[model samples]
Structure formats: C-alpha cells, structure tokens
Target: MKTKITNLQPGMIVGEDIYNLKNSLNLKKGQKLDRDMIDLILKSDITEIEIMDSNASIGFIQKTFEELPNIIDETIYNKWIDSISDLFHHFTKEEIYVSLNNITEEIYKSLNVKEYFVLNFINSFGNDSLTYHSLNTAIIVSIIAKKIEIPYIMYKQTVKFSLIHDIGYAMLDDRVINDFDSDDKNALIHNIVAYKKLQDLKATLNHEILESILYHHERYDGKGKFHLKGEKIPPLVRITQVADAYTSLTELGYTPYQALSWILKKCGFIFDPYYVGLLYEITGYYPTGTKVKLSDGSIGIVLRRNEIEFFPEVLVNNEPVKTGPDSNVYIKEVIE
Candidate 1:
C-alpha cells in the first residue's frame, strides 16, 4: 500500500527501498517502522512510500530503534572504498568522476541534519590505507564545505577533487607510499604527478579543481614543495590542504582533538589561520568522541558540543552530563 509519511506507524513494514531527493538510499525494504524511522522519513522530502500489508508480519521479530545503527550504510560505504581502490589500480577519468558524484550524493544523504552525530562517528575511527584516507579526507572536506556554506555546485566539485587529490600517490613505489618519512624524491612529486595525470581531462575538469589538487602540497608560509605562499594558493585548495593534513595526522594515531590542536599550533606557519579557524569552528575545542578525564576524576566520551566554548555534553556511566558553568564537573585533560 502507498502511504503518506503522516500515515506511518510503529510495526509497519517498508514495502520497497526508500530514497531521498538525491536518489540516495534512506530506508531499506522490509524494515519495520518505528517512531524514530517515521520521524526520519518525515524530515526528508519523501512524502509517500510503499508499506507492506498489515498481515506481512507472520513471523517477523521487530527490532527496536536503538538496535539500529545510525551510521552511514556500511555496504555502500565499503563499496565506495573498493571503488576508489579500483580507480587507483586502473585510472579512468570518466569512471572516476561518476563514482565521486555517486559517493557525494550518498554523503549528502548520510549527513542530512545529522552532522554532529555523523562527524563524531567518522572521527572515532581511523584507517591508514590510501583508499580509506582518500575517502576520509573527502568526507572531512564535505563537512568543511557545509560549515562555510559554499555554493552547491562548487561543493560538489571540491569534494570530487578531494576524492582523488592523492591519485599521484598510487603511482609511487609501494615502499615510498607506505613510508611517511620517506626521503625518496618520488615522495615529493606525487602532487605534480597527479596534476599531470589529470591535465589531459581539463576539458571535463575546471582549472581551479585541477590546480587545487596540484598545489595541495603548497604551504601558506612559502615553504612547501613549490613555495607558493599565502593567497597564491587557491581558496578551495587551502581548505583541502587542511582536511588532508588533519586526516593524515589522525591516521597516524592522533586523535581528532589532538590533530586539531596540532593544526592550531601551526597556525599561519604551516596552515592559513582563517581556514584553520573554520576547522576549529566545526570540530569544536574537544571534538565529539574524544575521551577525556573530568575534574571529578571520571572518564567520559564527548557527546556533542554546546554553546559554551570548552564545555561539551559528555557520556559517562551511560548518562549524559553537561560540562560548563552550570555543571560542577568539567573536562580536565584529554586521554591521549
């Protein structure tokens, strides 16, 4: 039966896969409807959906909403990672662009009004492989794009650029690619190589996108590989640089809070202060998911940031505790 969202009720089963306006999957077929799921549907543009007949639950054991994971669809996410890995192994400009577009669409669906939860979920995990790193950086770039309120078209282009910004790394020797401190000359030329590889597709790609990938290695203080300093670097490229660095640092075992703190210390020396400020604004003083010790000698995970500067809601003993002027407890130190 086709039913309007207002008609949805608990225990109702989805008759077909439901997607959002961008064609990203929202709910899977056969999922038993719950209050939270109904609310999610209501929040989206989807007005009506197919629901299973009332007799469909012959042997069904409905799962509670709490049992469902609120993260991105794992199947889609893993497929995207594999798609990126395949692109690295076999380079095709057209196919790569299509894949990126699809991935961005899914990202939009995942982040819809769930920015804080989604961002915290992403920051809580880390992977050192190039494929995962590329995807992670792209997601971070998307978050920053949302924070800055860039035009939708430009946001898409920026995210696509980030998805393959390190394609040149795939061309390097395995040993060099794996060694973070590699002194080999090939390590220094990955950006140039990536630029040249994409240079042929200029008709399909804009100059800013290509240049952003090319000069991503350039530092703000005129000390990078090409020494292109300050405003000489493209604005989008500056954003990418910050995202790339933060992702890389976290992959190297730095917590999100630690990575942001490291980036803050660099300021204008290694990064543009303006862009760095934007990064801080989105992630807050202590990013969500960071484990910290409180003034009362209890450990808690940051739940979310509040209006207060340094205080965020924390989850301790399975209960939320707000830390700020009103609460006696406050975060004392990060748990590394």
Candidate 2:
C-alpha cells in the first residue's frame, strides 16, 4: 500500500524499494521499516514510501529491488566516495612524498561543489562517520574559500589542507586514539605525528601548509596543544581549526545546530572570531539536515539557510516554511 511517510508505523514492512526525491533508492524492499529508518527518510526529505501488503507476492518486490542500484552506488556519489577514499589511502602508503597539488586537482575535477554539499548531507547519516567528517570539512573549506574570495591558489591549498589535516590519526592505532579524547595526550601526539609526516614531504609541502597541519589544534586563547595564542596562529590554520572542530563535533552525534552552537560559544577564545563568522555564513544558524524546534513549539528540519542568518527554509509537517522577519517563527533550539 502506498503510504505517506508520516503515517509509517514501526514494524511496517516496506513494500518496495524506497527512493528519495532525487529518485535515489534509500531503503530496499522487504526490509521492515523501523523508527530510525522512518526518521532518516523524513530527514532526507522523502515524503512517501510503499508499505508491504502481506497478500502480495514478496518475490516480485525483491526482483524490483535487485534491478536498481543502491543509492550509495549512484555514479556521482560513488565517484566522490572513491576519490575521498583514494586520498585517504594514499596517506597510509609508505610514499616519501605526495604531490599535493595533483591530488587537489584530481578531486576538484571530480566533484561539483553544489552537488557535493547535498550529497554530504545525505551521506552523513551513514555509518562511515570519519570519512564523511574529512570530506565535509574539505567541502566547507571550498565554501569558505569562495566566500572570502581568496586567490585561486590559496583556495586549492585550503582544500588540500582540510582534507588531510587528520591524516596523522591514520598512522595511530584506532583503539588508542578513540580511547582518549581529542585533547588528550595520545591524540595530541597523533597531531604532532601527522604534522611531522607532512613536513617530511618537503618536496611537496611548503612552510604554510606544514604549519597548518601542525597547529590546526591551536586555540585562539592559547590553551591549545602548542600554547599558540590568538594572532600568533596562522590564518590558514585558524580557518581549518574551526572546520575540523565543527565536523568532529557533528560526527560525534552532535546535531548540526548543537555543533554550531558549541563552536559559536567558544569563538574568540577557542576559535578565531573572524573565521567563526565566516563559518556561520557557510553553515548558517541552522545548517542543512538539522532538526529544530520553532518558537511556536512546532518541529521541523532545516532544508537550507537563506541570506538572513537566523531565517532558513524548514520542512515543518512536510511543508516548506520560510522563517524570516515576516514570519513569527524562530528556531528555539536544536533537537539533539
């Protein structure tokens, strides 16, 4: 039975392969719909799904699912994932040097910025949080690059810097790294390790890029790993620092708004106030995919942020509501 997604009940079996608005298959046929799946579907902006009718033949539906490619495998999405994975794997190799510019151009040519953000929002809900965080930060770098209208060379360098900033963790034991908080001793060592590794690639790394990698964890107030204070931190490092923190917080189960709020609260002290402002322009008050509560106690998910800081297009009850001065609606808080 065709059913509105809101009407979907727990344990309701999916009748067919459920596709989102983009016609990308999300859930497969014969899978029993659960609360998490339903919520994910709604968050993805999928309005409806087919409910399984027990009286119908299961084989027919299964056959249909087999005929379609999984949404993650869709050409563009898969390519982006491959490119990110490839870059990540390169860090794991024993190569003494990597052509940073070559890798940057390869990824740049393979992705469309606008489409990449949408894909990131959709795919962030998946299991590979680490990879998504790296990619998300890189995408954010591009957005920041364009917004600041930096020279083309600097923009490319920023992308490369953000993407591999955490590659140092790749060399560490996952168990040990996860055992300690990011600010812990082991974690700090990994950052130093990654910085040194990049520094060793002197053939490709410049002083600026090397410092950004080494000092990305430096705080604006001087409480960071190396005790580098505000103004002492390099500009590129300051920008990537916020991007890394923002992505890490979100990956650790913080809602987008929750993460942004955390970043905002620490701005000027923990992060560069100027860069945080730039981040706000890119992510907005309510970033895309954040579930929010409105002034009137209604629940909604942010679709996109508009020119106004607080005002955004939200999906409330499956309807688009624009929040602005004209509308009485205001986002109360993020629904974590």
Candidate 3:
C-alpha cells in the first residue's frame, strides 16, 4: 500500500527503490523501514514511500514532457519539450547517433520560429531540477549558437553536450550531487566522471564535443579546476558554461531577469564576456512570456523586445503597451 513517510510502520517493507532528484537510487527495494531510516528519509526531502503489497504499483520516474502545453505557442513549445526529453534520454542511454537525429529535427524546426525560445524553456521547467537544467540549457544553447552563427552540425553537437553535461551526477554520491556548487569536491569529480564515461562508452564523438563536456565547469578567468583561462577554454565550453550557470541560477530562487542580471554582472570575471553579451542579446532583461508591472501600476505580459533591453512591447489587458524612455510608462518591476 502507498503510505506517507510519516505514517510508515517500523516493519513495513519497501516495495521498490526510491530515487532522488538526480534519479539516483536513495532507498533499495525490500529494505525494512525503521525509525532511523525514516528519519534519514525525512532529512532527504523525500515525502512518500510504498509499503510492499501484491496490489502496490512499483514507482518510476515520470517523463517531464508528458503534459499539455501552456504557452502562447503551444505547438512549437510541445515539440521542443518532447525533443529535449527524447534527446536527454538518448544521451543518458549513450545512444549518440540516435540523439543526433532528434536534435537535427529540433534545430531545423527552430530555424524559422524565433519567438518561442524563452516560452518553450519556461514551459518545460519541472520538479526535477537536473532535467529542467538540461532541457533549458539545451534550448538556450541552441538559441545562442544560432545568433553566434555556429554551423548546424556544431549546433547539434552543442545541444547534445548541454543535455548530458551533468550525467556524472548519477555516478557521484547523492549527498554531494545535491549540494549544487562547483566548490564542492564531488562537483568537480562528477565532471571528470562524466567525461571519462563518455570516452568509455565507445560512442562515436567529435573530439571537441568530448572536450566541451569535460570542461563545461571550467571558468573563463582561469579559476576552475584546470585553471584554463580565456582562449584556452573551447568556445562551445564557454557557451555551455553561460547556459549552465543561467539554468542553475534560475533554479536557485533567482528570477529570470535577476538571473540574467547576475550572469551579465559576472561577465569577464566568471563567464566569457562575448558569450555573456550574446545571452543578453538573445534573452534580454525582460524576456518574452513573463509579466511585468509598469511605472503606472499596470500589468502586462512581455510580447517582444526592441533595441533597448529594458524597453519591450507588452500585452496589457489584451492591448499593446510600448515601454521605453520616450514613453511615460516604463517597466517598474518584473512580476514574480
């Protein structure tokens, strides 16, 4: 029978392994629940457990993309969500060639469609932070790659790198992987683990793709593990770093605008200046699909951006509101 962790009895048997946010097994099947074990589960942020029974269903990780769309462009967002989910699973299973086919289709579809990039990302966010990070990173990478004029092949490869760059977390200890800081020893160790696993998998890969995944955590200012600085880091790696950091910041209680602002501020110090500029150019301060309050106390959803980062066209009560210095109305605050 399914039971809450607080309601679990001392002798109840675990029906199946329970996984953490990283998809690592936290509790093994058939383990008997005790007060101490229950205490551990509570501290781990886990809330539910299954008691063994003939009628009880085994637990499994549900796909994040299995849902109806909620954005302005539902069709395109749905395709991107499914493609990211498919690409993520393909890389997790080490099916590199198959993932290429899926990514190619995603890039091709995204070429003519320019408006849904941020909306697609926001729609794909879920409870699984790792999966959300991977998907959002991939989408943002693809968008920035196009603006930087990277060729189709390299673009596809970069998306793949973003999707599986953190796969090493699964191999590391759950305690360390959940911490979310590169200063932690386990974080750097996972980067090496992920790189070595890619090589050991025997999957055909470009040398640069492997390098990018291996060094995605490296800082542009020679501050990271290998102390590689500036041009020493691969351009794709730098791009991936910006995207990865953006996703991490957004997941850690930073609003989209706040996260972008943080990334811009860290430019040249932590991230590559050129790529950070590209991120600002792509997502802007007021990204599409977000609501903001005007100086006149009006609410609106951002529709599109212009040359000015703060000035964007917004839909206010189903009417278009132009905001900039020239107009009396300007964005006062972003609606959280």
Candidate 4:
C-alpha cells in the first residue's frame, strides 16, 4: 500500500526500495521505519512510498517485540538506583567503572523504546541525593546521545562520566556538600577534586571522558569556574554541562517546564546554543511527566513530545490525546 509521507508512523515497514529524485536509493526495502527514518523521509522530496499493509505492519512490529529480550522495568530501575548509591559508599575507581559500564549497557538497550525510558526517568525523580542526581543526569545524557546518534563507544564514555561527574562532592565536608554554594570557594573546588580523584583510572577511561568531567562547569561565554569560553570547551563537556545544570535545577525544586525554560533563557551565555536546542528537541516545551490543564478543563500528564512543540501527547483520564492544530484540545497551562 502506498501512503503519503505525512501519513507515515513509526512502526510501518517499507514495502519497496525508495529512491530520491536523483534515482539514488534512500530507504531500502523491508526496512522497519522509526521516528528518525520517518523524519528523514519527510525532509526529502519523496512524498509517497509503498509500505506494508496496516495488518501486516502491526504483526511485524508485534513479532519483532515478542522476539526481543525484555528491557528495563521498575525492579531493574530500583536496582540501578541502589547500585549507584552503593558506588558512593564504596567509592573505588575500579568498582565505579564496572558498575557504570553495566548501567550504560542497560540504558542503551532501553533506547529502542526511548519514549518509555524518558517517561520512566522523569517520573522517578526523588529526594536530592547525590545518587539520584548522578543517575538522573546519566539518563538525560543517554537520551540526548541516542537522539543525536553519538557513536556507541563515545556514548558509553559520556554516560559513564555523567554517572560520576560529581564524585568529588562525596569527599567534601557535610556542610559544603549539603549547602552547595557555587560562589563559595570550597564548593567550587569539587570539580578539580573530582578530576584529580579520577587520575588513577586514566588507563581505563577515555581521555575525552576525563577532560569532559573536568570542564563540565565551563560556560559558553567564559563566566564559569575556569572562565573557558565557547568552542574552546570540548563538545562533550558542553553537552554534559547542559544536562548537569538541568538536573541540578530540577533537584532544587524547579518543575520540568521551569527548568527547561531557565536553560533556554540562558542559552549562548551559560550554555552552548546548539546543545540547548538539542535538549529542547528531546524534552519539548513541556517535558514528559509534567502535570498540565487542557483548554477544555481536563487535567493530564504529558506522555511524550509530538511534532508540535506546544501541544504534546497527553494522557487524560486513562486515554492518550494527541493535541495539535487539527485538534480542539490543547494544553492551557502547566500545573504546579
């Protein structure tokens, strides 16, 4: 069956090879379409393509899922939290690397259904423990990394670095760690301390990972701890900086919408505008798990982002409602 590009969905299978106007093959036959692939198709001049019939496409996706191994669940999520908490207590370089490696592998596996992963992560926010913050930052990095198609090895390195990005805080005094004033001299050294603490693991960890951890505080406009500015900072560090700040803000009681809004407001001055754009791409204007009220007086939780930025797919009264230009329903305001 031939379907217009606008009608394509994530689970549809290509029924034949698709060629561009220049007669170059774009999508191969039998390819199972994903959101990215659909977006690619939409961007190209191709307006229609042959896809498997609806019934067959549904069956194909169902069979593919049934054959695949189970991904993350609530039990595994708790275990990950416990493992991260344990890492803080044990505080060994070798153990930290091993645990983060395992956790990164599991996170990559869950990327196949990243929407669910993002939803689970947003809903899992808890008390402001170093453990929770570390894991939260890692999850956010994983989602961003996967969306941008960062290489597999580099993705693992970035996620691992995020998991231990603030390991230095564990070595600080209780007051310094708990209070956490950026302006305070004692609190500012945590980045340097973390860098030094990981020196012994240089043989095991990638150099980029270590460098990123050290410079994660570098602002895009040279106002950070070190005053390093703009392109002088490593790209990986810039990306991690945005994720770290957003996680910290949310931990400090900012709502998802508020945290993202703050980041957007600081773009170019505090964070790399390109990376900030990517964060918005992943989180949408109203990120997943945000409580909101609709124009029709119905309350709902944002389930996932849609092509439309302001109106996301929301779960209202046990049903998913996709709000967009064609729909009368829309999000009116975020609930506090």
Per residue, candidate 4 scores C-alpha lDDT tens digits across 207-294 of 8878877887787888877789999988777777778877765543455676788788889898899989988888788876678999
Which one wins by TM-score: 3 or 4? Answer: 4
lDDT of 2 by residue, 1-336 (tens): 789977986546677655554422255465544454565676776677778775553322111122222323345544555566565657644342344455466556654434313212323322233445566677666677766778878878788788777776566533121211243444567677877766556557677777887887778989886889999987777878777777665443345676788788888788899999988877677777677898989998777677786888777877888887788788887765
In the predicted model 1, the residue pairs found to clash are none
148-240: candidate 1 lDDT, tens digit per residue: 778889888888888888887777622122222334455567878878887777866678888887787677888877789999988777887
- Assess every candidate by TM-score: 0.71, 0.67, 0.68, 0.71
Worst 10 residues of 4 by lDDT: 59-68
Q: Which pairs of residues have clashing backbones in candidate 3?
A: none
**Model 1 scores what on Cα lDDT?**
0.68
Distance from true location, Cα of 124 in model 2, Å? 7.1
> CA shift at 258, candidate 4, in angstroms?
0.7
Candidate with the larger TM-score of 2 and 4: 4
* Off by more than 4 A, model 2: 1-77, 92-128, 175-183, 295-297, 325-336
- In order, candidate lDDTs are 0.68, 0.63, 0.63, 0.69
| Clash tally, candidates in order | 0, 0, 0, 0
- Relative to the true structure, candidate 3 reaches a TM of 0.68
